[model samples]
Each structure stands twice: as structure tokens, then as C-alpha cells.
Target: GAGVSQSPSNKVTEKGKDVELRCDPISGHTALYWYRQSLGQGLEFLIYFQGNSAPDKSGLPSDRFSAERTGGSVSTLTIQRTQQEDSAVYLCASSREGGAHYEQYFGPGTRLTVT
Candidate 1:
């Protein structure tokens, strides 16, 4: 499906390393989201971007985690000084406008393993 796509499907980094994850949403979708999933845990919302509005970044766990959307199509999530606890599946999702009620399509996550 041409829904959402993520790069570097798997990543391995040292505890202090930094990693950048990427997401590409569907052609016309207006909402993009990022989530993190630990083993055996549910998806934790990280950030959200809807159209040209200010992004909802309250869900980000720490200042070290940040994301940016360019041209409303591609998004990049950068994790600085990655720690062992930061090892998780980084998932990206996108949906058509209508707020949270609309169904979102998820991308295959980037599995980050911090050693």
C-alpha cells in the first residue's frame, strides 16, 4: 500500500548515538503522526502534525525527541543521545483530515536498538 512509509526499517546504535527516522505520508493526507512502541506495550503517541496548524508535540517524552515536517509530506524524527530505554519501534501514521475520528494508516516501523 502507498499509505505511509518509513526508512531504515531497523537501526542499531550505541547508547549515546543519535538517530533520525523518516516518514512519508500518503499523497493527499493532511494528518501525520509518530508513535513509539516498546516490546509488549501499546503505541505511545509522540507527535502529530495536521495541515498548516501548529503541531501537537505534547506527547513527546523528552526534549531529546523532536520531529519536523517539510512541505506537509515528509517528516523526520530525530532522537538525540539515544539511550537503552529509547530502543523501540518507531511508527509513523497518516490520515485524511477530520481529526482523530478518521482512520490512520500506519507504516512499518523503524526498530531502533540502542546497545
Candidate 2:
């Protein structure tokens, strides 16, 4: 009954701090995704989770960025040693299933600011 939702609509953090962003996908959706949008850039795929399979993390920028989806529902994206370059809108999306055929529903991204 709900759409994808991300937490702390806005986050302001220092350059070296760590932050954990949360997302709750629509119930029963078997596929979830994480993306980041930098100023003037297109959405960057960060990760993907489908059902109980191992997540696709090839899109993650670096070792500092990591994510996890627990019980095929809620997901958390953890950014370690945040950097100024990391300041961007973190978006979460979910679909009934994974692949090019399924439509993804997006959330009002969490805006992260590294000061």
C-alpha cells in the first residue's frame, strides 16, 4: 500500500563522518535498487537486491559505500568516511520484479550534504 520511502529527507554531515540512509520499499516487491544523483549528472546506480539472492553491488562507487537489504524488505546504505564528493541525492526504488521489463517506483530521495 506504500511507495518507496527514504529517511532523514536531508542529511548534513562532516567530511569524515559516516552516515546510514534507510529505505523502505513497497511491500511484496521482489526487487529494490539504490541510486545516487550528483549535481548535473544522471542517476548513478549503486546497488540492487532481488528476492533472497546476493545483491548486485557493482555500481557502488568505492569501498566506502556499502548497502544491505534485510529480509527482502528494508534496506540501508552506509557511507563510511563521507566525502564532499558524496554530497548528492540518494534515491531508492522498487519494482514488482527485476529487469528491463519491470517499472520502478521511486522515492523522494534523501539529500545528503557533506560540509
TM-score of 1: 0.97
**Every model's TM-score:** 0.97, 0.98
The residue-by-residue lDDT of candidate 2 on 11-101, one tens digit each, is: 9999999999999999999999999999999999999999999999999999999999999999999999999999999999999999968
The residue-level lDDT of candidate 2 at 52 comes to 97
Candidate 2 differs from the real structure by a C-alpha RMSD in angstroms, to one decimal, of 0.6
- Candidate 2: give the clashing pairs: none
Task: Kindly give the number of clashing pairs for every candidate.
Answer: 0, 0
lDDT leader: 2
lDDT of 2 at 85: 94
**Cα lDDT of model 1 by residue, 36-95, tens digit:** 999999999999999998999999999999999999999999999999999999999999
Query: Lowest summed lDDT over 10 consecutive residues: which window, candidate 2?
Result: 1-10
The reply for model 1, stretches above 4 Å from the true place, is none
